[model samples]
Target: MAGTLKVGLIGCGNVVDYGHRPALLALKDVELVALADITPARRLIGKAWFRLRERQLYADYRQLLALPEVEAVVVAVPQKFRPRIVLDAFAAGKHVLSEKPLSNVPAVAAQLVAAARHSGLQLAMTHNYHFLPEYQKLKQLLSQGLIGAVRVLTLHFLGVIDYPGAAEYQADWRHTLAAGGGVLMDMIHAVYLAEWLAGAPAQQVMAFVDALQYAGREPVIEDLALLQIAFPRAYAAIHMGWGAGVGGLDISGSDGHIRLRYKQHQSGGFNQPIELYSVDSDWRRSDHAIPNLDTHEANIARSFTQLWADFRDAIREGRAPIAPAAAGARALEIVLGAYASAVCGRVISLPLAAADPVYQKGIAGIAELEAWAGSKTKAAGLFGLRA
Candidate 1:
């Protein structure tokens, strides 16, 4: 590693534009050497934003990777294409940073993780929430035992989305099943926070899924779901939805409990702290203050700075990243388990076997809903959704 590693970034989508690009540009230790995006407009946008020359802008990522001066790569591409891109970056001897769901296919993601470990290159995931001040404060409080021995984790994530209607085909790829889009796409983050707070692996998962507004339209992916995960020493329930509901988290411990929330709108943006409460009944009740912000996307850029710093330090000091490939792989595996549970119509024990159909077929477990549907039309709505 040199004093300043030259960076080549792929994907100029929303995340790269608002989250990573700003963070990378602000870092003093690295040069933004190259950028790649399929969209010509986006390529020009990055070229102008970072002041890169036309020769440094590329339509094909491989051309960017060919740069001998490039020492690392940031991959914010779609979940499906990441395996190939990340693997290519590693083959090109570049340290990698990737945006999550690691892979829509767990098996392929596992391979990517293995490559990072065996290749001796750092692989960082953009799970920036873990780096947020509020979450950092929560982690600190837990370490101090403000709430002792957390046993239950509950998260309610509610947001609104217009039904795809006749324009389903033209909707954001996140709304499509083939792209691994669904209410649970961010379920991995909730699962990560739960495990981080609880200190255990989710041993099992059981879930129910619904497309709701698209009930009779045979949605390619669900927009609603409830995931129940059992840990070795505790349990977690995650309710994810695309329509009206409250959003928050509750953590219950042997001695006390903590509650946290946010208000999300298209305009004001995310993580606008609603409240944080803790009470033990014997001890004093505490109310912690949260941020008042203009946009959640702003904090995304802020937290990403910490995430990128973690990546840089890991590469510099030869340590694992704050959010490593294994952590992402574990979270991804649990999410897939919930999908399998929905299809199998039963509790799914985790450490899902390599041979599990979902491992290779990705969300292919959803297909089983067809056979499982039988004469149970209502049941089919859970997965084998019909018109």
Candidate 2:
């Protein structure tokens, strides 16, 4: 709390470039002291990016964890590989800042949360979307009752860019079964945002999961996810996919409505926001100006920096970060619930039962659940279901 925070980084993946790299470099009180990657090329890339000595680089993350200098670590590996590393970090007596989706399996995610809770160490999520300029402005307006109590929220991320992972590892790992669900799981920022904006945990979910982008390629995942989530007093519809489609945010409140559109209709975080406005009950429109309307990349970089600062202060002040591991676990369950809704053609309840197959095994559980004969998810051959 009094001095700089020494941090270690695991997995030198592409996310580190725009997200963690800037934060580690920009935050004066945070220092990225050690780097670890299974790939030599990625290790070299991280070494150059962080300017670490050869001794500070490691092929095995355990070696980095053994370093007593590291007070915390940022785990940037794929979801499937995150649990062990995070659990190990807790065992090593270090706080952890894990990448999104926490883990591919709900059971594993719960274990990680329990581990962090037992260790009394900080376990924050890389849910930097909470700090994005547009979303921050949106939250502020909603909090001020600019449109009265929210009744319905819609987030369109159909234009999500399908960026590949580090070439050193499997570049298209996101397209594989091990990555979990698909577009919905990949862009889980929208899922948690729905909960945060609604001011309540999700109560139920219904969805249509398909693979329009890779339909004929024998795809194992869905590129398209249309979800309808129900909260106690509000509902949210999230339309997401992997190709160029609609992109924006719309909110309907008791007194008015709010809208946000991105430049060139690209998804948020991919392009700058071009317009944000609200309409009152009288049909009068009031435009809101987004501060620091810099390049989308710059805004993303800043969000991560702010998130890192929050993680640092949370550890020092003995509090939870803006996005904690429990939030990540909840978000993951929401996505998995959407998948189950698609497969079963029914509204799946929230905080899925521990005995539920989806709760036990993530996307893989889809194959075990009773499938609806006419379900589009099954028709599309997603989750190992045959047409």
Candidate of highest lDDT: 2
- TM-scores, all models, native as reference: 0.90, 0.99
lDDT of 1 by residue, 81-147 (tens): 8889999999998999988888888788889989998899988887877876567767777788888
Q: How accurate locally, in lDDT, is each candidate? A: 0.75, 0.93
Query: Residue-wise lDDT of candidate 2 within 207-273, one digit each (tens)?
Result: 9898998877889898999999999999999999998498999999999999999988988878999
Candidate 2 regions exceeding 4 Å error are none
- Runs of candidate 1 with Cα error greater than 4 angstroms are 160-171, 264-269, 290-295, 368-387
Backbone clashes in model 1? 1
Kindly give the stretch of ten consecutive residues in candidate 2 with the minimal lDDT sum: 378-387
